[model samples]
Target chain A: MGPIMDLTIFGFLVQDGLTTGAVYILLAVSLVMVFTVTRIVLVPQGEFVAFATLTLAGLERGDAPGLAWLLVAAGVLAFVMDLSAARRRGSRRGIAAAAVLFLAVPAVLAAVALYGIGASTPLAAKIAVTCAMVVALGPILYRVAFQPMAAASPLYLLIAAIALHFVLVGAGLYLFGPEGVRTSPLLDGSTEVLSMPVSVQTLLILAASLGLNLALFAFFGFTLQGKALRATAVNRRGAELVGVSADYAGQLTFALAAAIGALSGVLIGPVTTIYYDSGFLLGLKGFVGAIIGGLAAYPAAAVGALLVGLLEAFSSFWASAYKEVIVFTLIVPVLLWRSLAHVAVEEDHD
Target chain B: MNRRNKSACAAVLMGLSCLAAGSAQADITVGVIISATGPAASVGVTQQRTVPLLPKEIGGERVNYIVLDDASDTTTTVKQAKKLISDDKVDVLLGPSLTPNSLALIDQMAETGTPMISLAGSGAIVEPVDDKRRWVFKTPQSDGQMARAIIQHMTSQGIRSVGFISFNDAYGEGWAASFRSLAEQVGIKIVASERYQRTDTSVTGQTLKLISANPDAVFIAASGTPAVLPQATLVERGFRKPIYQTHGVANNDFLRVGGKNVEGTLLPGGPVLVAEQLPDSHPAKAPSLEFIRLYEALPNAGMRSTFAAYLWDASLILKAAVPEALKTAKPGAPAFRAALRDAIEGVKDVVATNGVYSMSASDHLGLDSRSRVMIRIENGGWRLVP
Candidate 1:
């Protein structure tokens, strides 16, 4: 017999959708932020999530995460580039600042990864180390991979991002092995809510998502760096004229994207088993949301992603085999509406 | 002067004899295609690791293996298979490490008249013994054989209805098809059926649907760590019924990933899973223990994998058939390839790590009832279900 539609089932499905949607929201916001600021779609956003989860898993197992070494390597590359650039400019203070950001920070984290984080480490310490290790890579990646081609076309940047995604995925496999991992839940047990069972982990996820989004709103609406990023997104030439360093904006955007991705991973790790390449599909789903927003609107992307999550849940219940098809097919009508609503503009070829 | 002259003469004689033997018997080349780097890497890496452990020389002729990674792509698998057959001219081919890849290679194998020993799980790799599959053989136990074992266990447990969740691909679909037919024979009903992608992050809706149907048990037909998602979700959602899994999750990774969620899961798997637990009288016991000993002795051995055992069995089959093929024709010739295929088909009572293989014209997989045992996950390890 097929499942009968019932209130309990609907509640469970909604809870599931919201939980997954929360993680997708974090990813969608990051995707939009990076896309708007850098003119590059961050295809490797999912890698950050996978790396964070796997890093925590590695810490739980008491093995030093291989990602730390990657951070060190990237740090060295970025440092060299910065040192050379600073030397050409003949700025001693810039050299010192570069040394601090690109060298000292990664070295300290690498040391922590090597010695401090272990099986006996506290959960908070482990998560802190995991996030620091992953988040630091973001700026390093920007400086090393994207800075040189900051003036390149979006399509060219898109190709580089895709290539970067493959590199990270391959590196992830080497670091985490081929097996999937799921962390122990941050909080244990479930309780009744509205006559339905609600997991504490689900509550934590919802709370974290809400808190992070609020923090993001406050940062963007209040902070000078955030306004600079917004200015850079609106027009790089105008932002440069207004004394906003476009380079700093790109680096700051990448840092935020990585932090959001890492947090998403931390929350999602306990809920699902994640593999090295699991990021691509997760990122692709968020991308469907980013597309729904035309890659420019944050609230729209968030809403679109949640809708995608709800549609996924309902379709899985109704036609489990075609859930992916149904979920992805949503973009068709959305793209159609968006294109029809807006008139074509003159080409702004760079 | 006498010592130096005598040593020189002995070295010359040894070199002459080696040359003669080399001219007399050409080295046998066995080409292997594995999905060592992509989605199926969990399965394929173990099989790839077992390659170096395979015999370097079978029947006194040096065996050289040319292993290629398919990266878990079907087109890449076909390309590598063609490269091995036409370029390397391997005497016998082994593995692309997945059902879809193995199925794709059938036409290529048949056209080339090359003998292939697939290491994938699907029985469709060699079923019907048609003109195409006649050249293809596999080492893994068929889905039908394992299905009967599971159905027998369900009957013993007095479970009348079950919920089925499987992957949308061949491995899952093949298991579902076999299990359903067997369940029907025993008058057990499958109350609900669901399919999922391997990479799906959540199965909440599907699990909710299954729970609503309220079967006596849930049967999960999936492989690797992906299989853990459904069982874990079920436990999280308060489904307090028996959960049955197929042999696909017979690896240490699954145990490590599933942890407490997979405790009490019942499955039908190869004898290799519980080698030490098997009674001495069991035909598969000695080979299983021997296989385990060799596997554990490897330099970088981590956890024993059933996928690795399949490759080891493939090697055993190769060792058994190489001498017979040699009797008819020399290595690297078209005749030798045909002879090798015939020899593999004629292999009889070759006890392997999984089971005893007795091949015939009609059956190519060669595994019998002795290959499988009912097992339960107890205290995070496999225990024989009495």
Candidate 2:
């Protein structure tokens, strides 16, 4: 025990694992919440966060300190997009398509603004162009096409949405190449910024990430749109009879889910290097974590992610190669066990 | 009369098809069993990305790189290798990256006598299971060399007693055993040794197991995201003891995922980017830099790694071996390929733009003690420690 008490790399590894796990936890929980409300698993949740992070971080990151207002504005727009999608209860595929476009809007706007900055265009002109495009074209198109599509089943729709996300990412990769990462710099000269021992900044990054997710959830839960979403989720006919406007509520929930997916991508981008495939992997992990948490339970998925992280850390130390194999193997057995137990309980009830 | 006409038509059609096939045999075919997906797909992707840029001036002749995706699976590797050889009739071969896949191909290599080179890691890939077979050659150092390098570096830094953390696979087990042997040879003791399976991500039990027995430095012999990131977890928890990493975990992706936790970790040097910044007189510096510059210009590729230096040398050796095909064997494709193999086998002391490389009948390992350089992370970048 005394010798064990001496410092070791595995100890440090466990700590790092926890930190990364914390980030995963948030993603897992958000995904789980969306799944719980809609009954459709949002398998694409991970990719959404990655894309949103890339979108925001891809903005004029050099001036990000001053563009605090931009984030607020983007968040509100994203939230509105969420509400609209929630109002729609269209086919899963159509909703997914609409959601993909909704997420892309911010990234495109951010890209245009950043491109303008790079090309020596005046800030006012960039913002003017951005605002005009977003308002004049973005909302009009979204209202017509995406709003209805989103109200459909959230589960299968989640998968379709993520596949659409991959296409967008692929397009971005084709257009940006390696420079896409550079065009808007995810973090302000990461080497310098990351080096500064401002634990406060790290805390803020983590806190803001968590807070934004929670705040969005709160908006959905506390607001009238959120109430409508609940009514649609629990029972459509009853909610409609209660004058809840079930169709509108459906659209609002889809819109909210899309917004969450987009904002998540924005927050995650600065933490890791973005690539065409980044979204897909994150989406999968988030989906898995969501499932582990019973889909409807946000806090459970959060815990599941931390569990994944902790397991990952331990697995690396013990069986590095089998880390993934072990996690998946356990997942299947656990699920099988649960299914068997459920059957047994049903038999007892009979 | 109708039957005769039909028979005549069939004969003519078959004859024409055969003639067309022979007419299209202008390009030399070379097969690469590359990993297009899975964990090590990045390495395979890098190879696919880099191999095409070899100029015709260097390649002697442009060959159809019949790259078949192995999916990083053994069955896929075997099937792809068979198809390339039997179906594609490839002139030369490269890669089936992982150890098990490489080992699986040994009997095939011996039977076919195919002169193959791998753009893979796994010290055991080229090492003979039996002395009669010497057809395989590996571009990277063997496990023995890697273990020696790790032990030597750690001991020199006064890390006498080290902890062992490795995956329980062929790759990991081989390294773990070799490391213990190498460490014991140098009078270094391994205090705590723990083994874990590949898929288990929560190493809490394992890490706790290792930390419980604690040693001076911990040797993490692992690869891919699942294996490497846990080291970061250990570091962040304030474990300051020297955490020495295997050569496998020395890439940018690993460093990126590990972040500051990797700042002080030591990595065995395979090739450093400093070679690019150096002048001509410095052995490998000039040629390495030239390759980097040329490779950077490849569409969608850039100058990103120090390891690409070895690849440059590997291509150069193969290129220089081409002239032997003209001299020793006949002028045609098949004979020239036969000569190319012999020339490669006979290569010795050919001063590459980098350092002196010697290849022969018995010697598979390229460089001796002078070649195995070591480096450590200072401020998020790898720096050679004197």
Candidate 3:
């Protein structure tokens, strides 16, 4: 074969890379957030993405997804747990708050979902409901799976997260079946850039990713709750000593991660077909991006994800069979660099 | 003796008589292993659903089937095959959906002296007439056969050059190899070749490179829904040339997932996909329609797929073979398995849902060009083309 390099091909590859990289950036950022705050790898972050896309797809067909029921069930369980804890503490006000937030909110949402089934639902309503349902799952998952084990070591937390990942995948398969689904594009049409056509959906993904990153920046830099999360991330015991509840910070971080993952799902749902098991591979790619950032810096992770995407795009052109290998091999050097640069700190065993 | 002792002795005698009667007519068990929950799950799910459609009785003996999930993994397929042979003692084996899984189970099938009628498309599963492959047969048309149809179509359309993107696996490699050799014979140039993982989310870069090569058409060798990714990207990036797919994506899931982007794409598939559109005199028409009728009548059958038709054809082969095999030997014996394999190979001019099967010692696939027809996707449905 002869060399067939050209500017148009290069430009298109870049455009495609960026479109895919946008999703990875969101995932990498979420992974960084959850890992920093909770010390868990959050392996099932991609399940939230699949659920979001499938829920929107169901809504598009004028059917309510089983996700609504899952949310309500989780909510009721959490509510009952909170209610009992409040009762034991003799705090009536805490019980009321728990009931309204967990029980009332999910019940109303489920009612809305039931009403929308078999009736043509507006696109915006569908999008909102999909996003909200996926976001709601994060805290509930955290409460049910991680709360009791919050004080455990990172290894235990990782095992729990991995187990949750498998369970969620099984549930996703049971709920969605084995077929892959593709939703209608949020934006349709294309524009010529440098003699190369770019899709409107691609542009939307880029815009949404950038906008979310900016909003996250403001949240982390200015808000009190954000500061509390940062404090907990920096020093969990220190934050607890200073009256910042580590448990609350962990829940908040999980919610933000889930929201980011779901938003990423909605953004990319039209561009690719997603099966129930698709998210695991997608999330692993993002985890690779997170690893590239040393698992700490958000901006570094974002840039690293973009690089991973671009590498994958170009490598496919050069050697498509080994493209995955090329993309994953990038982590080796980053790991080597990090290990050489930083000294290892030994942890005390209990 | 007391009256109670006399009654117990009578009951024991009756139980022994029942056991003897059961031994005279034993049930024939067919073991099946398909990729029910992995990358090839879409194809396997369809094939799995067709199990219930199989005949309850074959060769005047009751038939029992034991199905297991391979999850699209080769190791799992081998394990399942072992379990079926040693534990279930199945008389015949049915499936393992994808090419790799089917290829992986060949040795085990031979060792166990059992016949496996695979649902995969790889010709290697039954080619070369090796000891291992002699025990193996497949329902789907071989990649070599489908490649000939595609090359014929391309040459007829005056296409001289084509690009290729295949999965980075055995299935893709098999098709690419066949297409390359066949295209070369027909004087068609393969301008570019690329491969991607089945789990890959994007193929834009590969599509870009192929577009740059400027082939008259592009052949995507991937299977299932993942096959749509590269083709969809090609259209999105303004590659207006004709695109072709193999028989792998001949199902409703591909159409549903590809949506409008796949409209007008061409591929070669079994006659069953367009059974209603085939000429009345076509050899596969009657059996194809019969399968469609029976399959569609099942509750929650959804759309009929060529993969399922392969299983339906397997059932037909087994129906014809079991009676002959039973005449020679009893079930659960090595002689019975050998008899079954010989009977399947001796099947001649047997019309099936996919095509007329004429298995022989040297040729196990038994499918010819008559089994394949070119199809185009138009208006979200398959349209037959000359």
Highest-TM-score candidate: 1
Report how closely model 1 matches the true complex, as a DockQ value. Answer: 0.75
Residues A79-164 of candidate 2 have per-residue lDDT tens digits of 45655655674434345544444445545555555444554554345434333332322232224333445455554455555555
Best by DockQ: 1
Provide the clash count, candidate 3: 0
lDDT of 3 by residue, B212-320 (tens): 8889999998777889999998888778889999887888878989988999999999999999999998999999999999888877878788888988899999988
Q: How good is the docking of model 3, as DockQ?
A: 0.69
Off by over 4 Å in 3: A80-93, A117-119, A192-196, A343-350, B1-41, B56-90, B96-101, B323-336
- Fnat per candidate: 0.84, 0.17, 0.78
lDDT of model 1, residue A103: 92
Candidate 1, residue A225: the lDDT equals 90
Tens digit per residue, CA lDDT, model 3, A124-226: 7888888888887888888778987988888999999999999998888877877778889887899886677788888899999999999999999999999
Two-way DockQ contest, 1 vs 3, winner: 1
Native contacts retained by candidate 3: 0.78
Instruction: Tell me the whole-model lDDT of each prediction, alpha carbons only.
Output: 0.87, 0.56, 0.85
Taking all chains together, each candidate's TM-score versus the true structure is 0.92, 0.67, 0.90
